[model samples]
Target chain A: MQQCYGSIIRRQRHFIRCLGGDRCNNSSSDTLLLLNDNTRMQSVMSRSNPAIEADALSILRSISPTLDSTKHKGQAGKIAVVGGCREYTGAPYFSAISALKIGADLSHVICTKDAAPVIKSYSPELIVHPLLEESYSVRDEDRQSVATVVLAEVDKWMERFDCLVIGPGLGRDPFLLDCVSDIMKHARRSNVPMVIDGDGLFLVTNRLDLVSGYPLAVLTPNVNEYKRLVQKVLNCEVNDQDGPEQLLSLASSIGGVTILRKGQSDNISDGKEVRSVSIFGSPRRCGGQGDILSGSVAVFLAWARKLVDKEGHTLNPTMLGCIAGSALMRKAASLAFEDKKRSTLTTDIIECLGRSLEDICPVG
Target chain B: MQQCYGSIIRRQRHFIRCLGGDRCNNSSSDTLLLLNDNTRMQSVMSRSNPAIEADALSILRSISPTLDSTKHKGQAGKIAVVGGCREYTGAPYFSAISALKIGADLSHVICTKDAAPVIKSYSPELIVHPLLEESYSVRDEDRQSVATVVLAEVDKWMERFDCLVIGPGLGRDPFLLDCVSDIMKHARRSNVPMVIDGDGLFLVTNRLDLVSGYPLAVLTPNVNEYKRLVQKVLNCEVNDQDGPEQLLSLASSIGGVTILRKGQSDNISDGKEVRSVSIFGSPRRCGGQGDILSGSVAVFLAWARKLVDKEGHTLNPTMLGCIAGSALMRKAASLAFEDKKRSTLTTDIIECLGRSLEDICPVG
Candidate 1:
């Protein structure tokens, strides 16, 4: 725990350096005092190896853009989710609309033709593209051409997107996976940030090279996905004893790609530092909460990158994005739970996104 | 701004002349006094080119018919919305249902065959007619016959409607627009008031002759639509320095048709006078709010027209309708926002319409 606190201080110093000494003067001391108090509280409350908790709310406030009348549509962020097939329309809809509810200027979903109309009907705010093709839809002879067409369609709008969220409702189809792989490569080439979740983790686990060594790529893996990743990369069983150390190793093995390992406490690691957002979340284990997190992460990642690019900030935007996204999703879930209790669904959590964001960083 | 206000008063007098003067004597002084107070407030606030704010709440109260046991089922209003296509079912549904919610006795939706069932499924309150046919459904050889058949279908029900809302989810289809143009002509012949919105605005902007010089026609244009209208009619860019004058000119250019320019503050004009409704409204810019406004406007326009016809009132029914509609929509939006906060969707705002109306003008 002492070593964990030391590492956090070191990371805090780096963040302070990025923000410049003059700008960090006030907040740095306050952050240190908060950390000291948290450490003291942890010593009294717990008798186990606790993961280093992150100041996710502060990170969220740091990255969130101020609402200005001068800023037009698509100025805050333009996020696109590369998912949604015949069987899984709600996942992409949840992710894309969650981005909009979280204050992104525009949210788009690139989905299979069959899913487009259904998703489009869900909300007029989303720009749904009926571009992806599944294996059953394409003949063996036409697979290559269809894949090429899908890539081309997505490529046309690639430059406009600040971030791409992959695999919320993305089903496991070989042809579709091939097309998404090509799309991922193109996004990587253009240096667009990505948040990978659900079946995207499946694709990445099998073909690690798709995201390996990509600093801007963020992989959000739940328990099963994380277990598979650990087995594939570390060639070992899941170790609960040194979870933070393993998560650190897992991220480091992926060549510094950030990993937000979702669980009881969302443990995030960018290899250099491992931080956990153990904030109060709803007990309701809803299916679509991960989709909301992916969407939230994409928006925050884009904003963080914008902040870094515009202000020359030194903090790892990917890590900051994961922390902020996790914290927000948890906050929204808690709020929804407070209202609906056990009946809270993913849509309820999504509806609370804007209010959660406003509570953290007011538009005014 | 003073000159603009003076011109509005002059136009108000002209409208009184059209309504036969005697009924204008009571409300005209009250409105002018409100304008005077607004002018004083504007000077103190150091505002430039301030629009003369209308007392929209009062207009809404005066125009809204009182509930009575003696009144028949359709006595309040019977509104028909001429929209909804394959790609859009929600917009027309929102408009039609909003009319019903805002005290209209009967609400009907004239939509394409593909959209009828879906719009009907949204609510049993709406009378959905899958009468309109798009180009895809009609062959080139059968175009004339199909259009004639569609017109005949709508014409049978035209006289029963108090007012027709001319576009909510009306998609841009050439054949459909042609059929709609024919329907517009028929409605004009019957002297039924038309509240044009969405694709109707698109249709009217291109073929201004469809609604040209029709006093019963009301064009509700949002920011983008308003820009297009200003470009097409005025042949210049939108100048905020002279927004009211430009809006008045735009209305006059369309031959005295009422123009409800929707924005942060809804600006209304009938070529004769300009009145702005800067009442409190939600900051959430979700889609379908325009649909609500169109429906609300249609109902109000019908009631205002009935009031004029029955009571020999001097106020311009169209102007009164726009002001009341704008005020009601804003109030509902504000109320929805207050409760739902950032989670406020168009549906949430629609739910508040009745409560908002009751709050403003309660039924004894």
Candidate 2:
């Protein structure tokens, strides 16, 4: 059912345009894609060198805030996810809600008008804003104004958000990306940290200047996304022999923006140092896990920035966020696997997050 | 083993229009979405105004009809769920199947052609009709004709269904919602009781005339949806300090229409008085539980109306139905949670529905 669900997601990812398109047209291609996925996972697993392992538990304990009775709601962390469209609702919903489940004080989703209700239906815990526009929904003449309105809507709450997790279900639409690019620029000006994953990486890779030299920006790319970034930024293929070195150079080329390359063992680099988190994660490679990672990174990043002293901290906030987030997600996934086994979905893993976090860093 | 497809394509999406369309978009800056939400939830938890607690178990036993060999299939109740789009299929299936499981004689799903097959694949028990048309499927020139044909298809079976559960996985397609609005009008004319939920609440919240003043219409709005409904109808924010009073006023403002405000404890009101069903429920906040509540309410409401002397019963059928349904759903959820713990999904709750209901009012 999960495999069928994964295919359904891939098939429906471009929902509005593909309403009447052939569902089984890509059968042979799907079979090949499945085969390639196996090979790719093995490849990803072999590439990471677990040489310089991150002190993930220590980082998690240090960055996490104590449960204070006096602190008001938003003091813990406030996260906003800029994604979800007519085509994709689950991805953004997964990311935004994961932030809440992992102890963020508040989570928000800014999505297209069509996507908002469905996403909101998933959980009322997240504040959903139906304030985005897609090309098909907007007139050509009204594009400029629509874009302006979209930016204004996001900007209203931009400063209030501790961090933004860009792209969980964000479709690759030209007009929507243009508006998001503008929003990213505003975030840059305001010094808001961003963790880019899923389609956000698709947007950031093509437009490097969006995060280039921005030390606060964190790019979390899965195997394929990492390959694309390596090819695009370094003008070369990924060499597994010197994995950490290649990752360091790629981050260096992007002028020190942190890159957490996701795989069997997650690798992190910010051009200054390289760290790998080799924590045990579940073998169930279900979809929507990346969303969980991105959301986890957003909260931890915010907290890490708050707790870590600028001069005294060994690793930067983004790096610390990636390491802690990676370790927690792995632990949660492992725990979910122990119970659900084959049926261990992203949702199940999400339900384990609080337990996993509490185990790693007990609250007083 | 499964049949799937919803076609009838884009003519002009959202023509009922989000033009000035901030319909569900928070008018209060979204940053305040957190401010109001945190305070309101805490307020709801701590409220102890000596609110009237409904005798839910007594209501359940009173309303439920006894199983007899002489009773025919359709005599129990007929339920139709009007929802499901390309983006969502699980919601309508959950709702329609739930009705059948909880003693409805026949359950039907009236959805877009594309959604019909997927919904059908979920269960053969449901009478799945792929008769609805989305805006994307009908062209501008063809919308009126398509809409008329769509209405004719639904009108044929309108009187047959004892109750219609509007909006479970119902996407926010303008043309689709327009057709649904027309259907709501027809159902109103037939004096068919409607249990409005999910996106149905969205449509009715925007255009209250559809259900306003109709004593048979029941609106089940979750915390956020209830907040929006109050803001729209009462022209004020949700004051958790006066939760029951606010609910009573909101229902009264809509001309005595029943409002089932879903929260920590389900608070119900039909203008005359407010009732709270403070039964112990599951702590797991999974999606699609609301659909189960809507479906359960539809079936119980039908039975309650049948058994209750309209002019003499202590509580109106809608209020009794709300109380009974709330109690049963909570019992089932609690059961599911005891077994599944935090890993419980909506399906888990649905599986518990029959057993839970039997425990309350057993068959001969």
Enumerate residue pairs that collide in model 1. Answer: none
Write the residue-wise lDDT of candidate 1 on B1-364 in tens digits: 7676565556545544443335344556735543758643453233344455677787888888889899899999999999988767778988999999999999999999877876777788989999999897888999999998899999999999999999888989999999999999999999999999999999999999999999999999988899999999999999886777788889999899999988766788888777788777876665678899999999999888878434433349999998999999999988987776645667889999989999999998
User: How many Å off is the CA of B60 in candidate 2?
Assistant: 2.1
The docking quality of candidate 2, as DockQ, is: 0.02
Fnat of every candidate, listed in order: 0.08, 0.00
Clashes of 1: 0
DockQ of each candidate relative to the true complex:
0.16, 0.02
Model 1 residue runs over 4 Å out of place are: A1-35, A39-52, A62-82, A100-110, A113-133, A138-164, A178-194, A204-217, A227-258, A269-274, A299-319, A335-364, B1-47, B132-149, B309-315
Score candidate 1 by TM-score against the native: 0.81
Instruction: Rate residue A87 of model 2 by lDDT.
Output: 96
Off by over 4 Å in 2: A1-203, A213-217, A222-256, A269-276, A282-321, A332-364, B1-46, B86-88, B171-174, B283-286, B308-313, B338-343, B362-364
| Candidate 2 C-alpha lDDT tens digits along A83-122 | 9999999999889887876667668898998887678667
TM-score of chain A of each: 0.89, 0.86
Model 1 chain B weakest lDDT span, ten residues long: B40-49
Candidate 2 residue pairs in clash (backbone atoms < 3 Å): B5-B114, B6-B113, B6-B114, B6-B115, B7-B114, B8-B137, B9-B136, B9-B137, B10-B136, B10-B137
